[model samples]
Target: MAEPSTARTLTTEPRRTPPAPRSVGAYPLLAWTWMRAMAQYPVSLLLLTFGQAASTGLELTALFFVFGHAHQLAGFGINEALLIYGLAGVAFCLADFFMGSVERLGEHVRKGSFDTMLVRPVSPLVQLATDEFSPRRLGKVVPAVAALCYALAVLDIDWTPARILMLPVLIVSSIVICCCVWTLGASIQFFIADAREVANSVTYGGQAMTEYPLAIYGRSVVRTATFVVPLAFASWQPALFLLDRPDPTGLPEWLRYAAPGVALLMSLAATLAWRTGLRHYRSTGS
Candidate 1:
């Protein structure tokens, strides 16, 4: 009792919880900084943008020439085919512009600089993407949007309430699919070390394929593309649904509405692959 009275009570201050993790601000700020950096080289940026736009324009030109002769692909006339191509362009532009770094992940891995992203508070993926954001890539949007507008002007859709709402949703789903495909490509780097060429084959080729009717491909090819890679879900079926066109490949009509779900699943798969790859990654000393 005497000893207890003699000892002064020691009070410990309650620990304050760390401030809530902030993800919302990090990416926007990082993206702004990166955009500023791109602004430093006005002419070079202009040239890079022009180059991208020109290349994509040539792609659309090729499609025009093909349709000019064939006049139709599967059941898709030039107007409908152009609709698919235009939406696909918009989808690819959104993905490539926002997440251009997905292709160069191997280089980052080789340099071991990707490790730096792991120590940050925000998501490594978001950080990587924002760090690599290219403002110049937005130039491609001009041609893509132009194509989409041309399609809209030419095609006569039912344009019901659901279709109106689905337009933005379709656009978003397209972006998600394209981005996930790019992420999948980056994930492959963990296994192959340098698979940019392979990844490009899938993403760029898949993108090109999406611009046309899948019915044009062989049966086996269409089956693989639908069930395996599923790139067709990005824009083709959505275009069919939004424009009230029929699917010549005989997929269920309801499948058109499944674009958002497919996009989510692909995104989850890509994320899982990225985490798996991250665990397997061996940092190079350089």
Candidate 2:
């Protein structure tokens, strides 16, 4: 009878927005985990580190032998040659320590393990590079630093303000160039599963070539290194600026300052190659 029934109001709680996904700390986390695992075996780590140092030390010995045969190589005195060797060694060792593991991409692709990296919420490059990170690789830096110090002390360089600034810039650019080369070489693995040897020939062989005066390799080799791979920027070109020396191959004086730009271009090329390789990758379907 009575039409005064109060209508019940339906109330709904505000929907809470789901929290955003957290950023993945890929490289630091994986690298730390590997470092912890390696720490569990102290003696093995020490021995492996020492072995790495000894192997690189032999390269220095070879340099001394080269100098013993003559006071100058390709018109570069012993000190100048040592400067090149030291700078190249430091750059290569630093690059290898960080990016060397990328070379295993071929093995990962062959075994179908690379597929797992694709599904993770992280860049595969960081994961692959930090995988099984080893402290032993830092061992090579010891001799390289020592050699650099000795060369800097003994070389009669007239260090102007520009040269002083160029020293660190050159070293940093060389490291970037070397790392780019590693990534570029690793990109080849996506197409050629067994191309590790070929990649090594480019990355390691380039390092070997850079560890001395490019002048010793003849004009043809110098030209190839300059225009083809740009390996000359890793040590030769910027080093000439640092030492206030002329390019033995008669490259333009401005080329001495081109290392940083070359490194940037190499970085862009490497990044593009890696992305293209990833797009073309086919899973092993294991």
Candidate 3:
């Protein structure tokens, strides 16, 4: 999936980078520094924030128009579909906001800043993950939370104890899965350049998949989203549980409860992939 056109020239020989720093404080400091840097530019902040929300809004608007004609999608009313969109948006936006720095790994690798990360006494992964935390991204979160709240108000699902408990878990698990997707993509930067398209296709495209009910998708798509890629764990499975809907796949009713576990597994897998990629690094010789 890595395109050579965007890849930087480097030796094929691989070697290990430096060990991580033990200082825990470097992480908070790095995150705070990134926040302050963003604060210096209010206009950029506004644009970035509004731009993300606008993209999600456009998709929602198109869905609205579709509903205006047909009144439902895969048996979901507009508000029900909005619920899926909102939950997915919150999860995706939170990942983009919190772990956005992962997106910059390619640039760091190309510019040799990744070496700087190695020289530091802190963990390179943590440093890179926190390097770009834009508080303005929370602006996008506002509308998403609003949509979710609207869904909760309008959807006829009963809030059982499990549902109430899983609500927060859903948001948390979605965030983790999205970050793992970003980390996996960023890891590709260690092996090749401009993995952005591949990463976006998986991460953002996965979110796009989540914006709709999974009931309409075919068996292959559902399996890919479940066992292979696990997008369903982030949105669809949880939605089914919360909404009291049955799994069309007939896999297992308990699958909905496994969101957090799925996220955890993905995070572990991503970390392993990143570490593997790091070991293969033949630096740019900068």
Candidate 4:
């Protein structure tokens, strides 16, 4: 009995380590989560999407009406103008789809909900941008894509290898520049809580401005957009190159290829602004 008692000992399993936290896939995961939530009510999503598509269609109709009356706008024919509109629309839609929700930063800051994002493992920018992700925004892309495809099909251009490559490059650069502008706008909210309208003026206003030939605007306005705001690179400059048209504003033809460089610089500035804003952020004390 004593020997049996001495032999009575318990054995346990080895302890397992916990998994590592996510570094990547955080944005898509959060965006997908909100998307799934929205998908629960398919009818509402469809209606909202339809509304978006309809609104975009109306804008295109207005463009057609304008073209019907005037065969050319600012020296650009119907197809050329449509190319500009389509390029601007696609770029703006993509930026808005990805980063538009960042505009609500002011609301989050005011409600003190932004503090919650700081405690999470994911990036605050990623969290904010992916918040309330909706598929309705994608509906706007349909008309834009249709316009682009139609323009590309009808527009008679000498498509070179370089020109063909520049098409995607211009689109990508425009998207990046728009995204940077959105980030810069969001960063401004860190200082001024009511800057949403001002930010929208830049983002939305820039989209509207780029949808047509820059030649329609005054030289001062065109220069401001080109050198100061760099919005010209979004559509006008690249479209000039694509159409083999000269700059009515007297800007150098080489500026057409400068979109990528401008986009890189804008990216740097936006990143710096965002980091500075984050460092200066104060909790709402909720």
lDDT of 3 by residue, 236-286 (tens): 887788788888767788888888898889989998998999899777865
Q: Which regions of candidate 1 deviate over 4 angstroms? A: 1-20
Clashing pairs for predicted structure model 4, backbone only: none
lDDT of 1 at 36: 86
Please give the range of 10 consecutive residues that has the lowest summed lDDT in model 4.
1-10
**After best superposition, candidate 2 residue 192: deviation in angstroms?**
0.5
lDDT of 1 by residue, 113-211 (tens): 788877788877777778757777887777778888898887887888998899889889989988999999988998898899999998889988888
lDDT of 4 by residue, 202-239 (tens): 89999888888889987998999998888888889988
Clashing residue pairs found in predicted model 1: none
Which residue pairs collide, candidate 2? none
Best by lDDT: 4
Please provide TM-scores, in order, for all candidate models, with all chains considered together: 0.90, 0.91, 0.87, 0.92
- For candidate 4, the TM-score is 0.92
List candidate 3 segments past 4 Å from native: 1-25
